[model samples]
Target: MELFFTSLLNGVTYGLLLFMLSSGLTLIFSMMGVLNFAHASFYMLGAYFGYVISSYVGFYPALLLAPLAVGAIGALIERYGMRRAHASGHLAELLFTFGLAFLIEEVVHLVWGKSPVPYRVPPSLDGPLFTLFSATFPTYKAFMMAVSVGMLAALYALLTRTRVGLLVQAALSKPDMVEALGHNVPRLFMLVFGGGVGLAALAGVIGGNAFVTEPGMAAAVGSIVFVVVVVGGLGSITGAFVASLAIGILQTFAVAVDYKLPFFDRVTVSQTAPVLPYLIMVLMLIARPRGLMGTRET
Candidate 1:
């Protein structure tokens, strides 16, 4: 029972982290109609950037400023690179992002080397915060949960309660209509794209230390983010959130269980836990071709 509760807490924290990454990708894809292959690369960049910034200024400042820096880079990419690719077509845009992902990886290697950096939770947040059911929860993990929920709340408020939010939703489906109303649709697109990537970067800053920080960190988690987006529904933030938490909990609980399949006695269930997300994704694809919350494509 203690083990079950402990795994539950871990799963929730992990799920919230996945939401941080998936939310940004969902927003970018929904608004721009682009599957950003490079989104995870931005996450890797955030970790590297946060590590550097934290070394000099401390984790608090890195947490505050790293996302802003990453967002600015995303905005520039939209303006100079993606915008040009958009003019050519979706294929061109996807190819551009694919190449950009590699470029970011190479840049990370050049700047930070291929080794995992020493990115640790801040000393202030390193200790256990509380105990439940004979299980101790780390202060850092709780902090992550709070930050994730706060970001989720802030995003919801921005979109549902503010003029900018309305304009953003309008821009997603009716860019031309918004443009006709004297709004700058292209600039809004840039801002949305940038903001989305920035959110990913923020996830990296928090998740890097929680997981591992290395040149391959993006590739390590990149596919899962896409899976979350697809299972939840492409271009659906709410869907992404649901998928993220579900996957996180599913994976965490799978790891905690020790059982063997009737047919596959050679492999422990924990050994196969890594494949659970892909399995869920396959089932989702079969059951709902349009995704849990996605609209039918014409």
Candidate 2:
């Protein structure tokens, strides 16, 4: 029972981290109708940039500046690169991002090399916050959870409360109508894209320390982030949040359980744990084609 509770807590924390990544992707997809293949590359950039900036200015400042720098780059890509591709078609946009992913990886290797950088948790959050049933919970994980929750709340408010949020929502449904009302739809698209990338970078800033910060980290996490978005629903932030938590807990608990089935008596459940998320995704597609919270309208 204690083990179950401990794994539950770990899973929730991991899920929240996944939410931090998936939320941004969902937002971009919702607004632009584009599945950003390079979103995780921006995340890797965040981790690498944060490591370098934090080494000089400290983690707190890196937390602020790294995302801003990445957001600017994303804005530039949208204005100059993605905008042109948009004219060519959605396929062009996707291929552009797909190529950009490799470009970012190559640049990462050029600048930081192919090894994991020393992106350790800051000393202030390096110790355990509390212990339960002989299981220690790290302060850093708690901090990560708090940040994810806070961002979730902030994003919810921005979309539901503010005038810009209202406009963005309106634009999502009727870009032409919103443009007719004298709003700059293109500029809004750029802002939303940049903001989404900023969110991804923020995730990278924290997640890099939580896991590993290597050139290949983006590729490692990119597919999972997409699965979370797909399972939760393409355009639903609420769905993404719920799905992230589910996957997080599912993966963590799966790793803790050891079982031997009749046909595969020699193979432990843990041995196949890595494929569990994919299995869940396949089931989701079969059962709920539009996703748990996704609308067929999307």
Q: Pick the candidate with the highest TM-score.
A: 2
Lowest lDDT sum, 10 consecutive residues, model 1, at 289-298
- The prediction achieving the highest lDDT against the true structure is 2
* TM, every model: 0.96, 0.97
Q: After superposition, how far is residue 287 of candidate 2 from its true place, in Å?
A: 1.5
**TM-score (C-alpha, index-matched) for candidate 1:** 0.96
Model 1 gets an lDDT of 0.89
- lDDT tens digits, residues 1-298, model 2? 9989998999999999999988889989987898999999999999998998999999999999999999989999999999999999999999999999999999999999999999989999999999998988999999999999988898899989999889998998899999999999999999999999999999999999989999999999999998998899888888899999999999999888888745987887777778888898899898887788996544
Runs of candidate 1 exceeding 4 Å displacement: 296-298
The Cα local distance difference test for each model comes to 0.89, 0.92
Q: After superposition, how far is residue 214 of candidate 2 from its true place, in Å?
A: 0.8
